[model samples]
Target chain A: MNKTGRPQDLPLSNPRADRVRDVAKLAGRPARLKRGHFLVEGPQAVREALKLHQERLAGGEPGVVTEVFASEACLDRYPEFEDLAEGTNARLATDEVLAAMADTVNPQGIIAVCRFVDVSLDTVLDAGPRLIAVLCQVRDPGNAGTVLRAADSAGADAVVLTASSVDIYNPKAVRSTAGSLFHLPVVLGADAAELAAACRARGIGILAADGYGSLNLDALQDENARRRLTGAGPASAFDLGAPTAWLFGNEAQGLSAGELDLADHRVAVPIYGAAESLNLGTAATVCLYASARSQQEPAHGETTHE
Target chain B: MNKTGRPQDLPLSNPRADRVRDVAKLAGRPARLKRGHFLVEGPQAVREALKLHQERLAGGEPGVVTEVFASEACLDRYPEFEDLAEGTNARLATDEVLAAMADTVNPQGIIAVCRFVDVSLDTVLDAGPRLIAVLCQVRDPGNAGTVLRAADSAGADAVVLTASSVDIYNPKAVRSTAGSLFHLPVVLGADAAELAAACRARGIGILAADGYGSLNLDALQDENARRRLTGAGPASAFDLGAPTAWLFGNEAQGLSAGELDLADHRVAVPIYGAAESLNLGTAATVCLYASARSQQEPAHGETTHE
Candidate 1:
């Protein structure tokens, strides 16, 4: 070990090494469950993982990034990694070794093996978060990851996935998130009816993103704006600015009827054109942004009703 | 030919038939280009194609669906196809033949051979369109199709793809569109420079979706709402309610320098959280929806300002 405890000297040159295969096994679910770690690929995701790891370490918490592997070229391209990898189990590996260890065809010369960062639904709810996004039986890894990314973009406090959802730690899902997986708290394998009940008890409203819902999302946003600007509008069906959790459904069939029944309101993103419905990611983005915008602190000096 | 003009029976069951080979070949680019036809798979897509074809045929114009193939099970599941595919060359095929002729592992027992529906850029521009989405160098077929579907959901008048973008007629692209391909006009192989000029000539403002852009999309929408409600806000940088064309760049690199320079403004969809930026489809959806909502006919009896 280096005297300064900064990772420097390991030269990992063999693609067929046991260590490399162990890292690569994170690509599958069984291996991930066995090791309690997942693959974070590409430069952007690896950077975020390292940042989170350093933050946790500073807080005297266990680090999130267990191991980081990079090539000299990658380190040169992204010099920040040198400092971020401080005290991390960082190794300089050949491109072949890095590729062999990563799930992606090209992991941008950097990959991180990160501890599973998901927290309990109780942990998320205890924070009194203003906004949360929940996925219900969403089967597509790409769609699940896209929603998670969109949730992060909207500044969602946490994202919850139902038990039937595709594994969030799936390699393709991680890549689709574009590093947002590290940006927000995540709750895995949540039970929707129980979660909805917990939210209601906490005074958090539940809204389902439904194609057949009677409540139009645009109407709610317009009303929120009207009340914000002129201090006058029709009585709102639901307060958009209030703490809320939005439930998004599967890509093809959308939310099941039971899932819809649990929400305080089933809100449909208005389709202005002839499209029957928006795709899952698109719908979730629009709905979350609607809540985000309305919940944003009033721009002027006016007092907020909330 | 049947006296009722309905597809009485084809009884086609040979998977090795030349007709099956020809249909299957449409999955490739060369065959599609040579015949000027694309494969439309899945029931929802085929129904939409059949509707468009019947509409054009009723208008004394050429039909869109040159051929339709379906199984009895599919027809039983989606009874509307029986009426929709009328007057077209519809035929019954066995599951094996249908599978052989399809691009998808399962074409859901229905597939259609459709003529390309993309229109000329001039046709779109001359239609006095209020809103359009232009994709520049977007290589992912799924990304391209998602944006197209989002544009349709937002009621965009048309969607334009720069020459460098993926071929919209590709099967994956068409599948991702979920039948929105037939919902709105598409202009393929457009030159971005010429398109910007054309839009300008038509009094349309061009906005590029850029991550580092100085303009915040949320701020613009806020100003738009203020102007609509209280009729007071800072002189807006740009009007969201005007005739506009939004330019979305590639998924990875985004719009090149030249593409960015062509826009009247580069508008960034606000990343309220730690996400660096929204993915291409998400960004395009938010941008298009903002324009669509702003350009919507004011619900109240407000007088016209445009």
Candidate 2:
């Protein structure tokens, strides 16, 4: 604002002008994503970023944020920005500049460049790992994001998007996740075969969802079958306490035959209506919830509480 | 192609153009919709309409289709038009004349007028009656469409969108459904309380998906709880075969407290990621699949027959 003939009093424009432009470009390009960084625009995502920053600061680590930008009006609207402004750099931009940098219409007037937190399979396994969703070749960013959101809300251990899936850092995907992207380890570009093998090695059951599958998920969760699927025997047998990975496929083709064959179990969502198939994201969500339900302990009995 | 100055071939400059203008106006006016009529333009939807008409014809019912409009090129592209033209009325319009009635960009050069199909709850319930998805106040047309598509793929009995939801007939919603709209019975404009009651009357356990709910879906599918929810005696205690309905709420507010209270059970998708919530459609898909899984029978031992 100082040099661009805009209001000089706005704090978000001058200091972060270059960074905002970089974020805008980064959002459209996938190669830049491998740098282990991404842009989070819109007010909701930006607010989540700031909240994460605050949490990190409170915990004694310097916030990992790269930059933040907003219109002068936004800062005034969020008065708590004063505390946020203390250790980190926050800049003001004119509404026009902010809009130009935003991916959404009616820009939320705030944006941030953030470093992707390093989340490894080891970290997720260390957590009380019960459920996880693995997206395979899901090309749509919105679908991928929505799946991540479901995984977050369902308290899955982690969400791993395979190499062929949409870029998790895509702004559309990030927006669709509704802030779940920040709360969990969203590992992208994992080798599917290796990841599947690793999950199996760790006692995780790979449940693949297919439209043509003979086994019904309902059958899997049946009392007798549940005993077999979760009964203790060999480490190779299905174990409910061990991590479970739900494999979802592309929207058009669904899971490849090879991928489906690799799973320990193939499950189908029964259809009594005329629909040809459920959308990939929806299918993934349903499968994840089903697996979660199948493994859940009886309500009246003593068990670990969520 | 017949007569240069004929009403069908002539542009709007013709003195008799009022009839054609009225036909085009019918597409936009709600009064026409209220009259149980709607227009389908472009070749895709029109082609689908024709297929639906053929299916009706095969079923020994007279098709209620009113008219078809096409340019000479369109008729020429599908020479069968000449035979189908015998019993049905076809107006040959010039490109400009056809453009006047077209609803999309780059018109597909074909249009059809047909009576709207009225589907009721009883018709859907009687179709197969296994799995169903009940949408409450989902405002996004795209989300609504995606849910319909998912329902079709998952083979749900029907999709019931509450009165507060977006219009199912919205063109955008129709397009988003990817032809599933025509294949499925999508009942819209039902009151939430009334719909819940109807589901209850049918012995369908209304499971509401909410993030803050204390019960995980895994717990709901447990043998004893499922038996209790379905009110099935101890013999089928774990048999969750009773009809079930999955309730998904608005994108922003999610299920209202009142709606959640009305549900037989409130279940949550556990989240482990940073994003806050799954999109409405994704949540619906997950919950529907969970229900489907819980009700399906296991396949392992059933294959031991001769």
Q: Provide the clash count, candidate 1.
A: 0
Q: What are the per-model C-alpha RMSD values against the true structure?
A: 2.7, 7.2
> For candidate 1, lDDT tens digit of each residue in A131-173?
9999999999999999999999999999999998999999999
lDDT by residue for model 1 over B33-107, one digit each (tens)?
999999999998888888889889899999999999988788878877878888888889999999999989999
Mark the regions of model 1 whose C-alpha exceeds 4 Å error after superposition.
A1-11, A301-306, B1-6, B301-306
Clashing pairs in 1: none
For all candidates in order, state the fraction of native interface contacts they contain: 0.86, 0.78
lDDT of 2 by residue, A1-306 (tens): 122312235354443567557656766766355566677776777777777788888999767567777776676676555555445566667677777676776557677778776477667656656687888899999888888877776667789888878888888888887777777776777777877888877877787888887765544445333344334222323443346888888877888887887788777866645665666667667666655544544333333121
The alpha-carbon lDDT assigned to residue A190 of candidate 1 equals 93
Count clashing residue pairs per candidate.
0, 41
- Alpha carbon lDDT at A198, candidate 1: 96
Q: Go through the candidates in order and give each one's DockQ.
A: 0.65, 0.42
iRMS values for every prediction: 2.3, 5.0
